[model samples]
Target chain A: MGIQSVQIGFKHICIMTTVLIALILFLSFICLIALPSPKEIIESLKSSEMIFSLKLTLISALISTILVMIVGTPAAYALARFSFFGKRLIMTILDLPIAMPEVVLGLALLLLFGRTPLGTLLEDIGIRVVFTKIGVVIAEFFTALPYAMRMLYSTFETISTRYELVARSLGYSSFETFMKVTLPMARSGIIAALVIAFARSVGTFGTVLILAGGTYMVTETLPVTLYLNMSYGNLGMAITSGLLLLGVSFITIYMVEKFGGRKI
Target chain B: MSGFLIVKNIHVDLGEFKIEDITFIVDEKDYVCVIGPTGSGKTILVETIAGLHKPRKGVIILDGRDITSLPPEKRNIGIVYQDYALFPHMTVFDNIAFGLKKRISKKDEILREVKAIAQRLEIEHLLHRKPTTLSGGEQQRVALARALIVRPKLLLMDEPFSALDFNTRTRLRKLVREVVSEYGTTVIHVTHDFEDVWSLARKVIVMYRGRILQYDTVEEVFNRPCCELVASFVDINVMSGIVVFSNDKTIVRVGDIEIVSKDRVCEGHRVKVFIRPERILISKSKPVSKFDNVVRGFIEDLERQGNILRVQVRIGSICLKCISTPNVLGSLDLELGSSVYICFRSSDVRLLVES
Candidate 1:
């Protein structure tokens, strides 16, 4: 009943909660990795379908991440720096994908690129988005763009505009200042964002499933591969795909930890 | 009309701090210091002149060119902040060479210029180190070298010595004066430290509530402040009274005390009296002298501000502030509630109309 005892009790509760969750996750991962024999897992990993899925996932994720960074960095900088007429509305729309369900975002994107006039105009230009390999990249880009932009926006916000002003006063134009000062200052943040965007793009499942159709050996990524094989009752292939996705996650987290704290 | 830089009726509204109808002129190579309390829009005024913020309505003409709408890069102005604002990503050498590189593309020329400025600022050894690794004084020297390497048309410094220690500030002040004089660069320094004004400024601009209260030579602003706000800001005591005697000396009676001023005034006319605290002398005993005013009062308060002690003495209803050194306080053995005589000569008091 004493204050010290209660404080000790609260600390124990926090530590217990963290340890309990970590233990459960570790046990679940063990169960997944132990579902099949080692030889069967190796065979599943060497399968043609698994190879195609792994290659597709990496290529699509890389393309999507590059596209996201190129488009989102300026958007986030604008949101952090300038005041426009519809800034609030634009910010809300940009953040909508992060808060909304991924399947819903996929459905909205499907409608925009499939049935709308803009979709028809794109089809006239001989560009097919839905139910194709391009749909995988498009889905991943949309799924990861908001997270990358949110990260970059806070990064730009933390940097004082005074640095940019100093550069401008030192005979650099606005764009030149951005390149020389602002971007270098945000270097670590940009690296962290890139890691997160690549991770998010590789792990995107619902959007890819709904838009890219999760086609076998054609548009399937690792997550889609796991889903498809699980439906077909192939435990070895499903577990192998899960293991590969876990490895990618581990690498991305390692990349973030390695490069996130580097000083310019 | 004869000034090198003319700021005509400029208005700026940044929502938090608004500057209204500010107009001032700076002659070429004049070292002007802007002194004001926080949130007085001194920074905004300099930024507006530096082309960082466009004034809502006014004209800024520098060297006979209307540069009101030009960008900061096009204006060729250099600014140094109190925090240094040095680029953390660049080395001290690269930071000093940044502006020079923009003008001259050759790498060797840029190196020569950066080294010259670095040597002038006494920061040659710090060229290879990052700004974060250096001390505050060192970083400020680097910032000065960066700003001065370009030989800017006008240099604006926002309390550049505020973050440094007393010794470092004194050294940097000497260095800044020497370097700025050698370059003949016009400077508009904004600071809350009066030492900067006394040591560096030939002209002082006192701003209050987003408006400039007075702009004149340092002696005039400190000795003969134009208004009550300027008087208080310059640490001069302001008292209102009616001129009761207007002959050989003008005697103003406030409450029960009569103070004499050397300035001429009409009889029975209302006026305001300004007296500098350092000009008044405090004593424990009544001194017989040819002094114009000697009043008996009790010490209301005593405050030690650095080397000088500020004593507030209350005579009847009015309290006058007087400045004394710690040595004087120790010798006189003054404390709160100690009765004392305050003496000031008539010529030390400046007067103006009450309107």
Candidate 2:
């Protein structure tokens, strides 16, 4: 074949592959939609077990996101601004969870909370974290901390340190300068990070399932509910939870793009 | 009077360049210009005094107190950057009021001070507008107003006018001079423009390779540079030769040419000669005076740089560049490859110390 014919043939093959992928995705989406009408989905969503699971999922995720922000702001700021020994090693270890599979992370957390002296000490203090409501939060936190930290670190990095210096020169102390200048500058980034962390925590499956044991109504979140119902052959409840999770993710991404995609 | 602000042997090593044994003193309300080429640690030097960069060695004393270890906030020094660096999110009024709010508690007083300074800078109308919405000159005025509203003990500007157009630069220079004099703020401005020195500074410090080469009055540093390096960096011509005694005066010879200098140098001692380009006069024929230095050379090139014309004449291996007005070139009918007489007074030939 001539060069032009070969080029046209390659373009045709590329279009065909793209169309095939789109077709498969669309067919799967249609199948998911055809499985339930709005009335059936709403009925399943309003069921007592689904209601409890969804409420617990949202509350635990919100708490986890707040905890992540409160603890991650300082950690991310320190990583972004300061140079000290072992910083690179610390940064690499912090990012390790993002690279590792969530199942492995779940197994590691399980061992730490189930088999370690630290876990026993916490249990003696009446803080039971294994297979409880608190366990769901702990699992979500472990899954979401790295993403929150990365987003916040990039946010702090984008801001010039000169703003703080200028504030300091204006007769304000370091803490005051940060409160007045740097925090306001990084507001949008912090919001975006909160949304992402909350979304990640809500959808967390492997970590929550292993640590919280997918118990019904007591420690079950939406993902755990979906997993439990799928194992029990309750297809309607499982698909309803899946659709709810998808809706939450779409809203979170839309809000992030609308507000945080511009300058910090 | 002797100790307004003293920097005692400050040393900082940032890996690329370091300031070693740099020391200077600025009297209160002194206008000092630190002139140097790029990457000469000029910004580091000023920022060190502003308490932004902690010196690796030595102390910074301000107003009879040691502020070397103090944080930038406690130093009370205002710094204006070349980029203007006004907070993009804040309006001009808010930007100017930022420092004032930290000091004064009353809102009316802050408004009065901001308006007064803004009016002085002729940026009062831009008070409600964000910094990004203002023009470059307006933003610069707001930056100045913000820095000055605080009435800082020391004002440090790093090439503040380098970003503006020529007319705006000249206008801002005049405005800065007026505002600084009215405030009587001790100022240390770092710039590469010689016009900043000529128009604003009473004292000039020429820096190179992270060291102060010459620190003296503007007249002293311009007329009497210390060495060949300072001469070249300052764009002055320096020739080295022995001083020969002739007719109750001394003459310095470069190659086969002899030129009389009014400045006294010891016979048999080598001295560095300095002359500014604008001090020389070019003529088609020799002038009437035979005592001054006059040389006949062919004009190798003529270039009009801005409003001034640069005439290069070939005299042996030494090519001397003289700056003249376009009117002077027209009157002399000078062109390339034409023989011309270059005359400069004996008093204009400065004999500097040879290293």
Candidate 3:
């Protein structure tokens, strides 16, 4: 039904509910914009630990997004185009990290690294993951992987396999077809996926907290910094980190919606 | 062995629609249309030939090379889909050159080849436009250019014109014929439209229920469908009639109506009669030709079939469908419940078989 032609009483109720919901969101966003005084934000930014966390957060999120696209593209492609044994089981396991709580995933990773033989071998080789910067990357990677796969899978699914067949018939090998044809077609979806994965990686807290221990300055990504600062009664720093996250998420949603056609 | 493209006894099990021992051959430079009802395994058969789907049984040989086990890219066979699967992200030039680039590494050679094919297909002007911006016909032409520019050994088109407007279909049909012939490429086209068969195909293969019923020259299949299902599938009006009298002209009585046929049958024998709807004429007045078998009937129903109007006439207990141009129908003052004279030549009424 057209909104203009709705029943009067119901329309009034609906419009009131929608406007009220919008106002709630608008007021909250206004608080985010207004709460951090310019001086307070500058002070938080000037803090050496805050600067380290920002730098580390950006680096790790970039690394994770790249790793996500590299690993997730093929996995998504396989799940989308190929028929193989144990397909459904593989899909379920890949999505389980997304379905389960991030803290639980972080806890599981903590145990496997702290108690498992693979972790011991890596430790013996002078490489460590638990309670380290490397552990931060690992936790963020698993947390953001399912989101990337979901995006890339839907992206690959929208492209007609016929195009690939045509490319193949025209004499390009399968890999070439993907690069010249499938990749170009899926560019927009890739952008959307990158934005999402980066945002997820940036906001990842519980997993990073549990695995990396939310140390004072070492493993303090943005979310970890917010958690650690709030626990220390550093309201200005905590609010600053939260606002930074909110700004990144706004950009992510804006980018996706702007180029939303490619999303599945 | 009979031709450059041979699909021998191919069988593919796709769960919903199985290709059961399907086989056909296209002589060098021959344009063959594989016509079938929906779910008749036409796409599956063409895909099998294109190396998109490996057949469970049988072999596909193109230019004397066994390609059944090869992947689609290695077989060098191009396919054009009904939806014109032109890559939306690429400009028309890039799309046409996409396949060409794989074979030719030099930029100028690829440019020259793509421009040549695009010019021939009259889509050279659309090279800079993305496929999404091009019209449906333009997109299909770009698709054709992309397939043809590669100089494939075999080109498989899956209902390419099925999604285009009639004017565009007619244009693309001629364009496809001219371009493919110029390249001397063998083509296997899958379509349910008879127009594609009549306008473009040198040979026609009639399929039904995932099986090939008849494969022969287009004239032979249209005039002489090998099975009852094929006859009906091709839109022939089939009716069971009893042979009333036999002579130089045979008379058959269907229900309370009598039809004249050229095929002789023994008296009192039951037979199936086949007549194409386009072969029958609907006029308000009787034709003076002695060769015409005229019968009076009231219009039972009228359905608009694109440019033609299909008038179903109630003749005794059977409804005979007669197709007439809308112009003819408009001037004839025809309507439901209105009486009209439907006539067909004795030669058009073929006797299928005696039961």
Question: Per-residue alpha-carbon lDDT of model 3 for B1-355, expressed as tens digits?
Answer: 6778888888898788788977777888898999988888889888888777778899888888888899887888888999988887778898898877777799999889888888899988888998888889999998888888878888889999988888888988888888888899888899978889998898999888889999999876776577787887787788888998999989999988889999888888888888889899998998888645899999999999778888899988998978888898889877889998999999988886653
lDDT of 3 by residue, A122-234 (tens): 89998799999989988999999999899889999999888888888887789988998899889888888888899999989899999988888889899988888888899
Off by over 4 Å in 2: A1-31, B246-250, B288-291, B325-333
lDDT of 1 by residue, A79-144 (tens): 999988999999999998999888998888889999999989988999999889999999999999
Candidate 1 vs candidate 2, TM-score winner:
1
Winning candidate number (lDDT): 1
Ranking by TM-score: 1, 2, 3
- Error at B124, model 2, angstroms: 0.9
State TM-scores per candidate: 0.96, 0.93, 0.90
Going through the candidates in order, state the TM-score of chain A alone for each one: 0.97, 0.91, 0.93
Question: Candidate 2's residue-wise lDDT over B1-355, tens digit each?
Answer: 2578998898988788887788899999999999988888898898888877778998888988899999998998998988887876678899999999999899999999998998889999889998888888888889888888899999999999999899999999999999999999999999999999999999998888888898999887887888767777778877877888745567988766887888888788788878788888889987997538899888998999899999888888677879988898898887899899889989888886475
Model 2 Cα shift for residue A97 (angstroms) = 1.3
Candidate 1 chain B minimal-lDDT segment of 10 residues:
B346-355
In terms of lDDT, the poorest run of 10 residues in model 2 chain A is A255-264
Task: List the global CA lDDT of all models.
Answer: 0.92, 0.87, 0.87
Residue pairs with colliding backbones in model 2 are none
CAPRI classification of candidate 2: medium
Per-model DockQ against the true two-chain complex: 0.75, 0.63, 0.65
List, in order, the clash count of every candidate structure.
0, 0, 0
DockQ computed for model 1 against the true two-chain complex using alpha carbons: 0.75
Taking the tens digit of each residue's C-alpha lDDT, what string does model 2 give over A1-264?
699999999999999999999999878877777777788789898899999999999999999999999999989999998888999999999999889887788888888988899889999999888888898999999899999999899998988877777778888898897778877788888888999999999999888888877788898999888889889998889889988898898899998897677473
